[model samples]
Target: MKIALTTSGENLEAPLDRRFGRAARFLLYDLKNRTFELIDNAQNLNAAQGAGIQAAETIVRAGADAVVSGHCGPKAFRVLQAAGVAIYNCEAATIAEALELLKDGKLQPAAAADVEGHW
Candidate 1:
């Protein structure tokens, strides 16, 4: 399985970026091979009204089976689900920490988002 984690830098010690759409980099780990790679989030971070849809697309294209992050918007979450990728809920501060949680099955899918205020 390939898993992506929102990260702030190129190393595993880098803290997790809470803002999914605007994250700095995505650390991808291939469970089968035990290898790590970084997926740059430049485009999504610079997009107007970025809502994570692009991020999800990037992850899907990179062949990730799941994504771990602090939060994700509704549209992107749905897109990821449609792409057959699972979402892992977490507030991890580093790549290693996120991977540890996942290895321990400590992360769970977050509930779907609902409106919290009127427009």
Candidate 2:
């Protein structure tokens, strides 16, 4: 499966970004192939500006089946949930570390959005 992780740096050991859409870099990792692909998130740099919905759409366009991030906002959370792409919350930064959680079955599936404006 293709997974997206918000990272603080280009390094695999870099901490996972708590903010989803506004993360510095978006790392696209393939579980079956055991490979890593880097995506630049220069366009979406402000998580609090309410860019989560657009960010989620971008991830989906980037071929990600799942998104693992430290935190996300209501807008993006709702978009992802509606799109059927699984979300894992509060995971460590970097695709490598996040993969560890997925392997150990430590990552939890995200629940429905707690927002009122979702449609």
Instruction: State the displacement of the C-alpha of residue 61, model 1, in Å, after optimal TM-score superposition.
Output: 0.5
lDDT of 1 by residue, 8-118 (tens): 888778888776767888999998898999999887766776448788888899999998887777777788889888888787778889889999999887667332211
- Give candidates' CA RMSD values in order: 2.7, 3.4
Off by over 4 Å in 2: 46-48, 91-94, 113-119
Worst 10 residues of 1 by lDDT: 110-119
Evaluated with TM-score, which candidate comes out highest?
1
After best superposition, candidate 1 residue 23: deviation in angstroms? 0.6
**Colliding residue pairs in candidate 2:** 15-93, 16-93, 52-76
Per-residue lDDT for 18-81 in model 2, tens only?
Answer: 7777777788888899888888886777444656777888888898999888776677877887
Against the reference, the lDDT scores of all candidates come to 0.81, 0.77
Clashes of each: 0, 3
Q: Estimate candidate 2's RMSD in Å.
A: 3.4
Query: How many steric clashes does model 1 contain?
Result: 0
